[model samples]
Target: MAHTQKLEMLERDDYLRFRLPEALKERFKLYCYLKGITMSDTVREMIEEVLKNEDLEKLLQEKLLQEKQRENSRDETDD
Candidate 1:
C-alpha cells in the first residue's frame, strides 16, 4: 500500500468555515467515507461541475443563435 501524505491544515485566513446541521454533517461524513474522498474535495468537485454546466449552457445557447441566423439568411436568399 502506498503511504498517504497528511493534508496541510487550513489557516484562519486561508479558509472560510460554515456550520451545517448536526444530522447533515453526520450524513455528509458517512457519504465522504464511502466515496473515499475528503469532504472538501467532494464539495469542490460539486462546485466545479456546476460551473462547467453553466459554461456549457452558454455555449449551447450561442450555437443555437448562430444556427437560427444561418436559417434566416437562407430564407432571405430564397425569397
Candidate 2:
C-alpha cells in the first residue's frame, strides 16, 4: 500500500478578473445562483465544452495548415 502513494507537485489556481455591464453582471450572478453553481464553474464548463467540439477542432487545424502554407508562399516571394 505504501508503494501506491505517488508524489505530486502542488498546483496553484490562477485568477482572471474582468468587468461586464452592470445589468449583465447582475443577471449572470443571479442565474448562477439559481442554478446552484459558482460563476467560475459555469464559465469553465462552457470553455471546456467549446474546446472539446470536434468540428471546431477540425476548423482550427485547417486554419493552421492554411496559415503555414501562406507563410511558405510569402517566403518563396521573398527569395
lDDT by residue (1-79, candidate 1, tens digit) is 3233223332221455899999999999999999899988888889779887787878899999999999999999999
Error of 2 at 52 (Å): 1.0
For model 2, the superposed segments whose C-alpha errors exceed 4 Å read 1-11, 54-79
RMSD of each: 10.7, 4.3
Which tens-of-lDDT digit does each residue in 1-79 have in candidate 2?
A: 3433432223345688888999998899999999999999998889889878758777989999999999999999999
What do the candidate models score in CA lDDT, each in turn? 0.83, 0.85
Model 1 stretches with alpha carbons more than 4 Å out: 1-14, 55-79
* Global lDDT of model 1: 0.83
Question: How far does residue 26 in candidate 1 sit from its true spot (Å)?
Answer: 0.8
- Candidate 1 has a TM-score of 0.48
Evaluated against the true structure, the overall lDDT of model 2 is: 0.85
Weakest 10 consecutive residues of candidate 1 by summed lDDT: 4-13
Please state the error at residue 48 of candidate 2 in Å.
0.7
> Which residue pairs in candidate 1 have backbone atoms (N, alpha carbon, C) closer than 3 angstroms, thus clashing?
none
Winning model by TM-score: 2
- The C-alpha TM-scores of every prediction are 0.48, 0.55
